[model samples]
Target: MAQQALPVLQPHPSCTACDLATWPGLESPGLPTRVWDGGHTEPQPKKALLLVGSHPGVEENVKGSAFVGVTGQFPNRLYIKGGNLADFADVYLTNAVRCSPRTSELVTPKAVAACREWLDQDVRVLAQCYDEVVILATGENAISSVLQRKESLRTFHQGQVADVGGVECSVFATYLAAILLPSNDPSKILAIREHLLLVWRYLKFGYLPTTVKVPPPSELVGSRVLDPSPTTKLISLDVETYGAFERNHRGRLLPRQTVFHPAKSLHWDGVQRCDLVQTCALSWRSPRGGKLRTKVYRLDRRAECDRLVSVLQRLRQCCVLGQNVPFDVLYLRAFNHRFRRVLARPHCVLYELQVLNFLQNDQRAERSLKNLSLVLGVADYRDEAVDLKKGQRYRDSSDPRAWTYNAKDAQATLLDYEFLVEAISLWYGGDTDKWSSYSRQWYNEVLWLTVQMSENGVHYDVEQLGRVHDRHQVALDWLRDRAKRLWDWPMSGKGSGKARERIIADMIQQYQPEDLGLARQYSRRVKKSRLTGKVSAGKENVWLLMGVVPSRTPDRGKLLAYRRFQRLRKVVESYTGPLLHQVSEEKKTPNQQTALVKGVAHPSWHSVPSYASDEERSFGGTSQCRITPRNPGLQTEPPKIEACRRSRFPSGALVLADESQSEIRVATGLFGDEVFIQRETAVLG
Candidate 1:
């Protein structure tokens, strides 16, 4: 007799934070992803577990921990009132991702790149360890930390298990403990407890038990980190000056620091150089008075970038703090991108805390530094009023106002920081272990993340890419011709050199190379699926991009096409870099290959796809093929794109396959035929 499949309505354990699909790990032929084939199910998760949402604060960015933050009070409240902090079977807890994003704007691609692996790691481990993993989605930010669609989640509601490691599970949604009280139904403290209780029952034993309050803080459930000692003391900070010429809600410019000033010595772009950079920072200091003496750093030259990294390296047990850290993080990131090689590992940050408050606080009022101060009320900085505006003259006057302002801001921040730290001691953490523990359990959260995610390592394939450049000319030229043919556009060198450069640049601005390159790698597939599409997805993110360079010989090109991809399957297992995936795609599909190319793992992070196409069959075809899995989780899908028959397939290029469901022949993409599967798999016992 056919039995009815359990009415699954939630994510699987291997689904990561969002129940979205993802590769379990980067063993081989693995790619980052958020969605699973089973889709979202309504099945129950392993029982006796706690679900901790992601926080946008110090713990997350600075310490690199998931929960156990100031904002964690939201989930904490649930436990305090009804749910048990560790009442679950194994207390399976995780965010949608392991790391916080660099930008507050949350570009679709970046989000996927940053968290795909985190999602997969948690789910895969949990799935193997428990039969029912209870998920306590603490609002959208928390939910988004695990789930893919952040804006669409409802507070204090129930979720159906949609998918897992191609399995089923269940999720119970609830208001983030951060949500303000006294407004909504769950607005009342009593109601908040009630919601938590319901979630608790749902998580405890698959079926909802008519409980009324959260189980007692689940018996000191998790640990923050495994290591007994701290990693390093280096933090990156960004400041947003209060007195600025900005008036618009979108952070406008009105001669404010954000606005570009010709007189400003910091040669930078956008608000960073103008307003953000104008902001000051607190540097290495020694305790002098009631408050520690501080050093204010004003980056007047490019050398400051290197100097900052130097400071981070020098400080062994210190942590960096800042307001709205992304500003500072981005600057550092840009430096890394431009100069090549950023060995900097960030520590605590004030900015990460502020952003998390925006997502976790659940308040209607503007969540600013002032509001944060008000909420914490840890100090009396607001009362101390000095004619701060008068201090403006010193900003551009070249006297010493800038340094003063930087010093003052840093000191004031330092005072508040002390309070924030003391306050943090009261919070309990989950997960213990250096490699896996959430840092908050032991030390600062954001600081830990910086170390765990340190540019672990970067590798590139130069020989493989050389071929990519040769065949990419025609496409590059065509893109230019299209631009030149337009109305008042200039005619590039004889053919279309200038046109090519501009158009290609525009395309680089886009993640998809199909639009600018000779090959049509279904970028739409990436966009629609929402993958990170990065190089290191299997490890950090799930999305990967591959290219099919024209082979040395016609037959050789053909054989190298898929065979090359198969070879890469092995190297990708070892390199484990970031992926450039789309938002929706990161939720489910593995790295969508743009093309197939032989891969070699070297410590060089130089990989740029050619912006041109080919005329004489760019890539030949390959007959000798090996099968591999595309994602991280269970043995699923194929490393090879269906039966990828080729004619000029270019590396980092995508082509369609399977008429009814054609996919981009992404190089390093997966096939589940088993060639890449590991013979010795680890089981959770």
Candidate 2:
């Protein structure tokens, strides 16, 4: 590459124009300081890429060069390893701040503003070399200075192209050098790598993807907009729902007067009916030029709602896509029970982009539609462009705002589906049709079954649970009183670990000196901190103390009572209390053969395949995916002794079974351990 030297662009070695130059560390003896004549090419190279960092680090200050230190070399490795750019060395490097601050804290707004003069000159000169320069701003400070934005960087705007110093350049905002360190979170590392790869793709394409602009959704205006294009094969649908209750700052539900009856008692049945579909938006690729077109309709009237269901029923052959398809389907069903038939059709295809995204990436990545769309280079169409406020519910907003929001969501969903389909197809060896078949199989075999399980939850024997709660409460009270009488411990308050340790220490000190053997045993049971010489009251120490205490003494009796109290307390809190709240608020309706027994808890279940841990997978499900119930988390039931209760079927049938060494057996089968399998087979025979 031919280059030109621009020494006039360099700041004076001893320039003290900014307040950062007066910082104490910069004035330290023997540590040379300079107005960092940043990454100007030896002879300012024409037609070269520019890499901008936040500021000079300690090593950069010592070396008097850009990216010469550990932090500087980080981006070098990242660029090469990511395969985005051939060599970082070929890119001109510079900093937003020419002078190194004592610490990052000193690189405040004022310091950045002071350094902008020299920085602007460098960018303007670089603009002369190329029609439009491409700069990678690698931190918040660099991004802010380059974009002339405020202190913070809008994550979604990272890859946006903007004008800097009257020059149009693609400024790629990404992670700081510090995030590239080994000790940083692995997820952050992975995310930056993905961001760099995206930057490469953007440059290779030679076109900037600006925010998507959609015209105001065409209103129904007393007529129907449910008619789909005859040639349309795929449609993205999204619904905006009006929640009957508004959650306060503390998350306590307060019913809206419009939905709630003042004369009737507040109950679950009423609560369930409060939420209704406000509007529905649908977007499909235009048959003419392949542009996505969206239409929104208000479903406030019964006739309008019926029309939506009718339209959905008519689309049995077309595929429906959404961010969380199940959520939209459930809400639609709640709005109109007739939707059940539409969804029940075996030929009906639904693509849930949320689940698809989860399957493709690590759980650490953001799976929400907004974040995923931005990460995948889809237009934002949210935040500033939408003119929405924080903490404001769109469903409660004006019709125009709500409808616009819904329209954008549907459009984004279709765009995201397009991106993910191609990406997944590439992963499947360029077979898009194969990926489509695989996703459909997963939806039919896994997602739908889990949804049904969530809708029709396990039936609990309320009477049996009530009796257990009562018995445990009585036992807990007795234990609390007995413990208070034996030790000076307060029965009403939750005593701290230190308080327990103090009581244990006092008891050990009062042990009869003549009972030296007993004293020795108790002493060995607890360990004292070397610094404070105070005994620990951790659970392990308590268990050890239980083993040493005499069976007949007050200390042993109190210990047993305390242990029993803890077990009962756990049962009361984790099981009884939460389960009591989880019970259906509606009284039991007449049992029908086809229906799940009503008036029982219906906890939601999730199939988190990527998030399943080894322990979670052990008992989670046969497929090794963690299919767990939420709300009360029934899978996390307490130990038998603590529970001292049995859950029977609603019909009162009880059965018990266990597979011994199930994991070992499963592993043997998986790894083709014929010897172990044959042995087990022989034993069974």
Candidate 3:
């Protein structure tokens, strides 16, 4: 099918300062000639919402309405669904640049400046119609126009409230609808839902209900009861670290090059950051129901931390509890030698709230402390007091906000434990022994092993991995040059995805299987879209081209070379490069320096066992590789790319492996399967 003709707009009589006026196409027949106004149809909207998009699209220009195109309809659908809108008719919609640009890129700063007069007119009309307006700006241009600034989108955060034209509005600025429309990622969808919910919440209430004041850390610690009752069986603890929160998708901290970690420590921003324990909050509460006696320890102050050490020594006698308690334990051990020594003592019982929650609820249920607290009716101040989106952390010892946040976390953990214990007890038919046995054998045991693995992290051969990474880079560069020379197309940049698709389609149309020197059976296997008439460049097609050989036509050569290039790129990007980064560059600890090593990486591991009959136990790598044991994880490294596994374990390390049917044999023997056991023994023999 041929591409549709581009839409064109006639030059406005008022202005002709830019080339957008000269951009050509067919004259729009049914579209509005004049700038469009918002809320023209609605006389009295109960809850007025003014949505501002960057510019009108081809479809919107053709339809004579703002936000009616595919991109616009996506957000409109979300707003109607999530925000409880009666319909699109209930809300006012307009664009910053009223005239549809030939392309979004053509709607320049100068064009936006010229069109600001029209946008201002729309805002004024909408503001007057409603006593209070909720403005949702969906792009940089719209945000800048509404706020009357020349700054970029980074200057604003999502769900921010601002005064527009002397009218207070619960305003929100986010990625354009066009950008978000193509993404099917659940996180992105959830984020938009959260953003819309915040907008509606702020519209109803004057402010977000997150603000809470607490007694200062000094005062809290001063009044802290160090000695708990002899009968106390559980103590819940929580910690606020300096650089553990606010990570991007790749797990890199947002606040890089800060004093939180030494500049030398972040050569590649090690897999696990050198996060410091800012404050440790420990609580001893009545499991029945009452307020918790929580102590917020300022770890930066040596005097205050000593008091915390005394309490930690007593933890062995009582069961220590917290949400993700292993994380707190890891940071605490790193902070003080005495704390580590106290924790190393045998018979230490640790109760992790996350693990317990996982067993009690569905495996997919969110187990964050805030979420758990909210559902348990404990507290909902996760967003209050701190701006996590802005990468807020415990920057200094003097900040009371971090201390209060820490205190709240400890208190909430205690409350969550109380709730979960009862919930689990009731779930187990009030059989305390059954639940206790399960917790002891599964949750606590896994937590102990995970903490131990993290403390003694595996070592890697960085120099060897670096050599492999460099070789992959050289090969990739050669392939890119070859591609550019043959097709005059850049193969490794922003437009590469689209370029790959076009290249694949061309290869399929122009060349036969014999022409590319591939088997005829492999040809015509690529799936083409029925609607778009475009060939898929998905992983399946790429794999089919793996055996392709160089041929006469540049199309075949390009396709074969590109496929090889992608294979090498994946190894470097996913395996070798990240493995090299996983090795820490921080200054070694005293013991590490004595042994002449750089640093250690504490990659995360997770295990969750569902008691249900159908679901199997889930376990393996969580962060560093984020792959599972089934055809994945660090343990399942391919033979060619064995640098990580080969270099990881030290000399004299004892590696364990489970023989096939090990668990099956034990179960069958326990159930008195004498014939099966004899057959198993004969097979093994």
Candidate 4:
């Protein structure tokens, strides 16, 4: 089945700018407006469709009509003045809440009340004239003003029909035109116009129009949500510490006496640039990938971290990811807690940046979490470069270095977190596996907001928390001492590295009651009648545990191996590759759904290990291609198994399959283990 394209909801040209009348900060000759084509407006009956919205521009007040600004004027002249819909049912347009809402424009309670009455008047006027009416709330404000469901954007997008003060109504809510279109997309415009045209027709006839309602902008004033299900978010952060700790001959992170690297004040008269005095950069790339676009934010001010507190508060909505995102997050969290600041936003959804491996044994040495970015592979890391530049600028800028660098690093870290999420979407056909799990990680999205790119936190023991190294160290130390004492007969350096092995051999030879080289009565190799064991001579460099020795004696080969249970130095024999968390879902079976905390899977690592013998043989070795018996684990397949084994032997290896190159190839994900097969394989570690 063909997949449908995702709708790219964007601003319409008629509403490219914010309610222009509201933005006092902008210096505009007139509000941006667009006129619609009257030819496009379809004819209707006596039914009047009242379009309700929030922004009423200054031009609209002057012209006494909706959509009359530079942007609105075009649409008005095209659709209204030219007159097509006006021929049938009169089109009455008005704003639900008057005056423009802007970045700094706070709509007072009294102002809203006044606008409410004015909106009701417009609705009442239409109710008196039409036998049937359809009210369309063009934006969130208009829908919310009537529905009192401001946070209903999700549900409102689905369309709704409800009674508003006994006036039969179907409200269709959409984005404000002035806010949506600048980048032209003809198809989208046509679709929206058609939707409106059909909606008007439905109103004119007796047919009930489909409608949806969304939360109004005012209702969202305090509708922040926490606990993103599926998983929490992670926000990664890093800080660049520069200045020396100030103390009275005592080491302490002092506040008062410590001077920020770059002194405050960054006003360059006309141009806001300043000089730098040694600054550090905190860089990070993300989860599965990183941000390709570098964004440098100069932190020249000493109060940079303080300023960042607000930005981060907003960013904590989604999980943030990064290498050691915790370090920055922890630091930021501490700052907020200490300052008693209500971040307004929740704690950063946190995830440690990592590429986890899911295939093979779980004991392989973990790769260094740091310095493992795609940069080595020539991949661009926008977050790293930009943050580095920003740190330099911040150091160069005349601002408090600590504060600026801390927050700037936080931003960089978060960006990387975000980039990883984006990167996963690109590398894979869709966000699947580890990347998908990331969306569920704690504060991961929140962390994503902080950096350009981010990664998952595959548990790394870099600092070796929880005694993994200590246990191995103790075992190795005992063995080292044992080897030293075993060779006490001679301190010569002949077999320096293998002193213990030489000593053991010499001692066994000298103490032989029966000739040590004599062939045993019933065996060729050393045979142990008492235990199921093999002779050490069978394997090269095999360590033999003789009998128990004194615990204090330097003979760990005897004492540690035979008397005590010791954690070996090589316990971690193998490891899988770094991978992102795919999906944490339960695998379903014919019987029942699997348990939670398990649906995760990792990709297969084609980097397989090869043996020297396999490499030398080159042709048709099992290491390169396997040929299993046609019926595995069965008595009937004995001949097939033997044939398969002999074919892979060094003397019988073949270079080509069949008489010539096989043109038609077929591969099913399923592997019929019972059938003999061969395929090329890569040999790596």
Best-matching candidate per TM-score: 2
Model 3 C-alpha RMSD to native: 11.3
TM-score of 2: 0.60
- lDDT tens readout by residue for model 4, 426-523: 64657366445544553344443432211110122222321443454466556556545664432223553244345444433443346444524212
- Of the pair 1 and 2, which is ahead by lDDT? 2
Error of 4 at 628 (Å): 38
Which candidate wins on lDDT?
A: 2
Runs of candidate 3 with Cα error greater than 4 angstroms are 1-218, 223-230, 244-275, 286-289, 344-346, 356-395, 416-441, 470-474, 477-502, 508-541, 544-554, 581-601, 606-636, 643-650, 653-685
User: On residues 237-340, what C-alpha lDDT tens digit does candidate 2 reach at each position?
Assistant: 88766542243223545343321111111233343342455677888887789876777766756666676667777776788888877667666665656877
Q: Rate the local accuracy (lDDT) of all candidates.
A: 0.35, 0.59, 0.57, 0.34
lDDT of 1 by residue, 107-203 (tens): 2434443454555455655555456555666554445544545432221124345354453556555455545443423333433454465555555
What would the TM-score be for candidate 3 when compared with the true structure?
Answer: 0.58
Of candidates 3 and 2, the better by lDDT = 2
Provide the TM-score for each candidate, comma-separated: 0.28, 0.60, 0.58, 0.27
Which runs of model 4 end up more than 4 angstroms from their true locations?
1-236, 242-302, 314-318, 333-346, 355-423, 426-428, 431-433, 437-439, 442-498, 504-543, 547-685
lDDT value for model 2: 0.59
| Cand. 1 Cα-lDDT | 0.35
Residue 342 Cα positional deviation in candidate 1, in Å, after optimal superposition: 6.9
Better of 1 and 3 by TM-score: 3
Error of 2 at 400 (Å): 0.7
